[model samples]
Target: MKILFLSLVKVNSLSDRGIYTDLLREFVSQGHHVTAVTPVERRDSNSAKIEVEKGFTNLHVRTLNIQKTNFIEKGLGMLLIGRQFLRAINSNLSGEKFDVILYSTPPITLYSTVRKLKHSMNSHTYLLLKDIFPQNAIDMKMMKKDGILHKYFKSIERKLYNISDHIGCMSPANVNFIKEYHKYVSTDKIHVNPNSIEPIIQTISSKDRELIRADYELPLDKSILVYGGNLGIPQGIDFLIEILENVKLENVHYLIVGSGSEYQKLKNWCDQNKSDHVTLLKFLPKEKYDKLLSSCDIGLILLNKNFLIPNFPSRLLSYLEMGLPVLSATDPNTDIGDILEYNKCGKKVLAGDVISFKTALNELLSSSSKYQEYSNNAKKLLLQDYDVVNSVQIIVDRVEQVKFNQNV
Candidate 1:
C-alpha cells in the first residue's frame, strides 16, 4: 500500500524518535510505501524540497512559521497552509495515487488539501485526531464562542470530520466527546488510537545517573520531579506557579524543561523567587533531554483546569519509557489520571487543587515500596497500551476492512 501522510510536524528524518516518525517507520517496515508531507517554516530559511529514501519519501513544503510564534502569525499561517500544501502536492506528487490518505490534527485548516487528494486518488482517509480545535481555542479563551473565527474554524472542523472515513481518537473520552457533540459522525467511525511510540529500552546505571545529574548541576540527594514539555497556555502556567510558590517540601526538587509561549512567565517567576529547590532550563536536544529525564525520579504533567476537551499529552510516553512514576495535575475531562491509577503507575490530581497535588506528591515520596511498584507498572503500561505496533495494526486493520468491503 502507498500511504500519504499529512502533518504539521517537521519530519527531517524518519530515524528520529517521535510519535509520528515511529508510526511512519512502522508503516514502511510493514512493507507499505509512505510519503510524508510536512512544513519547513520560514524562520528556517529553507525552500521546499523532497527527499526519497529506501521505502519512504518526505516532501517539505515551505510555509510561514506556524509554531512558537505570536497568535496573529500562527493564525494566518494555519489559514493559508491548506492552499500551500495543495499547490505543492499538485506540483510534485501529481502522478502519485495514494491507497491511504492519513493525517493528524492541530490545524483543522487542511480540509481543502485532504478533500482534494481523497477525491483525486479515491483513497481511504483516516484522521489521527490529536487535537480538538475551535473548542480547545474557546476553552483557553483564545477565541470566543459563536464568534466569526470560531464559527469559521468550526465549519472547517466539521467538513474535515465528515470527509474522513475513520477517526482515531486519543482516548475513549475523545471518542465519546466526538459522538456526543457531533451527532452526525457515526460512532463506528471513531475508535481509540492513542499516541504511541516504538519503545526505546533505556537503562541507566547508578554511576551514569549520577554523572548526568552532576553534569546538569542537579542535586543528587533530592527527589527530582521533572516536567518536560511545552510551557504553554494549555498547561495552566498560573496553577504551576502557584504550586511552586506554595509547596514547602524540602527534599523534593522541581526541574522544569521545555520552551513555549509561557516560558517567559516561568523564567520570570524562577528569577524573582530564586528558590534553591527549583531548576528551570530551556528545552534541550532529545538525546540530552532523555538522559536528564532518566536521572529524575518522577514526571510531572500539568494541564489547564478550564479545558473541556480531554488532552492526552505525548510526554507521558517519555516518563513511562524511563520507568518514572507520573504525577499529572490536569482537568477532570482527561482520563490520563485514570489510566495511571488503574495501572498502578502514577497518581493524578485535579488541576488547581494545591492540597490534593501536595498530598499525592507526599504519598509517592513517603512510600519507597509503593514508588518502586509504580515505577515497574509504568513500563508495563507503555509496552501494553502505547507501543507503536498496536497503533500500526489499528490503522492497517481499518484500511483492510475498507478494501474487503469495497471488493464485496
Candidate 2:
C-alpha cells in the first residue's frame, strides 16, 4: 500500500520529537510504502525553493513556504500550501497509485486540498483528527463564535468531515463532539483512536540525569517536575505561572522544557517573579527531554480550564510510558480527567484554577512514597490501556476495513 500522509508539523528524522516518526515508521514497518508532506518555514524571494529531506527512500518530503507575513498567516499559509501540495501529488503520483490518502486537520482549510487529491487518486481517505479547530480557537478566545470567521471556518470543517472515508478522533469526547455538532454525519465513521506515546529505552547513562540537572542549573536534591512540549494557547501559561508562584517549595523544582511563540512570555514572567523553585529551558532534543523525564518525579500536563470541549494531550501518554506520575491541570470535563482519575496516575485540577493547581502540585510533591505509588499506577495504566504499538495496530486494521469497503 502506498499511503500518503499530510501534516502541518515537521517530522524531521534528525529530531526525536512529535508522533509523526512513530506513526510513519509504524506504517512503513507494516509493509506499506509511506510518504509525507509538510510546509517549510517561510522563505525570502532571494532563497525560495523546495527542499526535500529524503530520510528513507520510501519517505519523500516536499517543503515550500507560502508566506510569512503577519496578516492572516495561517489562512494564507494553507492557500500557498495547497498549491504546492497539489503540484507535488501530481508529479509524484507518476504512474503509481496511493491506496489511501491520509491527513490531519489544523488550518482545517486543508479539506479543500485533500478532497481534490482523494478524487484524483481515487483512493480511500482517512482523517486523523489531531486538533478540533474553530471550537478550540473559541476555547482559547482566539476567535468569536458569531463572527464571520467562525461561520466560514465551520463551513469548511463540515465539508472536511463529509469527505472523510473515516475520521479518527484523538479522544472519545471528541467523537461525541462530532456527533453533537455535525449531527448529519454518520456516527460509525467517527471512531476513537486516541493519541499514544511510543515507549523509549535509554541506556542507563548515570550522568545523563546529572548533566541535565547541571545544565539547567537545577538543584540535585529537589524533586523535578518536567513539562515538555508546546507552551501555547492550550497549556495556559498564565495559569501555570500562578501555580508555580503558590506551590514552588524548597524541595520542589518545576523544570519546563519546549518552546513556542508564547515561550518568551513565560520566560519574561519567570524573570519578573523570582520563583526559586521554577526553571525554564528552551526545547531540548527529545532524547534528552525523554531521558530527563523518565528520571523525574512527575510530569505536568495543562490545558486551559476554559476549554469545555473534550481534549486529550499526547503528553499524558508520554509521561505514563516513562513511569512518571502526572500533575494534570485541565478542565474537569476532558477525557484526560477521567483517565487520570481511573488510573491513579495523578490528581486532576480545575482547568486554570490556581488554588486547585497548587493543591495538586503540593499533594504530588508531598512525599517520595506518594510519588512512587502514583508512578507505579501510571505505568500499569500505560501497559493496560495505552500501549501505542498495540493500539495503533487497531488503527491499521480500521484503515484496511475502509479499503475493503471501498473495493466492494
Candidate 3:
C-alpha cells in the first residue's frame, strides 16, 4: 500500500524518534511506501519547494512565521497553511495514488485536501487526533467563544471530522468528548489510539551520568524534577511559577528545558527572583535532551486548569522510556493522571493547587521505596500501552478492514 502522511511536524527521515516519525517508519517496515508532506517555514525565505530526504518525499512549503510566534502572525499562518499545502500536493504528487491518507491535528485546515484525495483516489482517510482545536484555544483564552475566528475554525474542524474515515483519539476521555458532544459523528468511527513511540535503548554508566550532570551544571545529589516540552500558554505558566515559588525545598530541584511563548515569562521571573531551586534552559537537541532526561529522577507534566479538552501529553512516553516516574499537575478533565494512577506509575495533582502540588513533590522526596516502585511501573506501562509496534498494527488492521468493506 502507498501511504501519504500529512502533518505540521517535519519528518524528513525514518530514523527520527518521535510520535509520528516512528509510526511512519512502522508503516514502511510493514511493506508500505510512505511519503510525508511537512512545512519548512523560513521567515526570510519566500519560496515553496519539494525535496527528497532519506527515501521519503517532502513538500516544504514556505509560510508565514507560524510556530512560537505572536498570536496574530500564528493565526494568519495557520489560516493559509491548508491552501498552501493543497497546492504543493497537487503540483508535486499529481500522479500518485495513495491507498491511505493519514493526517494529524493542529492546523485543522487540511479537510479540503483530504476530501480531494478521497475523491481522486478513493483513499481511506485517517485522523490521528493529536490536538483538539478552537476549543483548546478558547480554553487558553487565546480566542473568545463564538467569536468570528472561533466560529470559523470550529466550522472547519467539523468539516475535517466529517472527512475522516476513521478518527483515532489520544485517550478514552478524548473519544468520549467527541461521541457525547459531536452528535453528528458516528460512534463506530472513533477509536482509542493513545500516543505511541518506538522505545530507544539508552545506557549511561554512573561515571557517564556524573559527567553529563557536571557538563550541564546539574546538582549531583539533588532529586531533579524535569519538565521538558513546550513551555506555552497551554501549560499554565502562571500556575507552574506559583508552584515553584511555594515549593521551596533543600533536596528537590526543578529543571525546565523547552522553548515557547511562556518560556520568556518563566525565565524572566527566575532571573529577577534569583530562584535557587529552579533552573530554566532553552531547548536542547534530542540526543542531549534524552541524556539529560535519563539523569533526572522524575518527570513532570502540566496542563492549564481551564482546559475543557482532555490532553494526553506525549512527554509521558519519554519519561516511561527512561523508567523515570511521572508527577503530573493537570486539569480534572484530562485522564493522564488517571492512567498514571491506574498503572501505579506516578501521582497526579489538579493544576493551580499549589498546596497539593507541593505535597505530591514532598511525598516523592520522602520515600525512596515508593519512588522506586513508581519508576518500575512507568516502564511496565510503557511496554503494556505505548509501544509503536502495537499502534501500527491497529492502524494496519483498520486499513485492511476498510479495504474489505469497500470491495464488499
TM-score of each: 0.99, 0.89, 0.96
Residue 191 miss distance in model 3 (angstroms):
0.6
Query: Could you give candidate 2's per-residue lDDT for residues 1-408 as a string of tens digits?
Result: 777778777655523445666766766666767777665555533322333443322323344453334556656666567666667666655665677777887657778778888887887788888888889889888899879989998888889989998888877788988899779889988988767655553343547667767766888887888899898877877888777776657777888988976799999988998778888888877666776776577888888778867878887877887777887788766878677777777888776677777777788778878777887888888777655676457667887887688789
Alpha carbon deviation, residue 14, candidate 2 (Å): 8.6
Which prediction has the highest lDDT against the true structure? 1
Off-target runs (Cα >4 Å) in candidate 2 are 14-17, 44-71, 201-208, 366-369, 403-408
lDDT order of candidates, top first:
1, 3, 2
- Worst 10 contiguous positions by lDDT, candidate 1: 67-76
Tens-place lDDT per residue, model 1, 219-331, is 99999999999999999999999999998698899999999989999999999989888999999988789989999999999999999999999999999999999999999
**Each candidate: how many clashes?**
0, 1, 0
RMSD of 2: 3.1
lDDT of 1 at 370: 89
Better of 1 and 2 by TM-score: 1
Once fitted onto the true fold, the runs of candidate 3 whose alpha carbons sit more than 4 angstroms away are 44-55
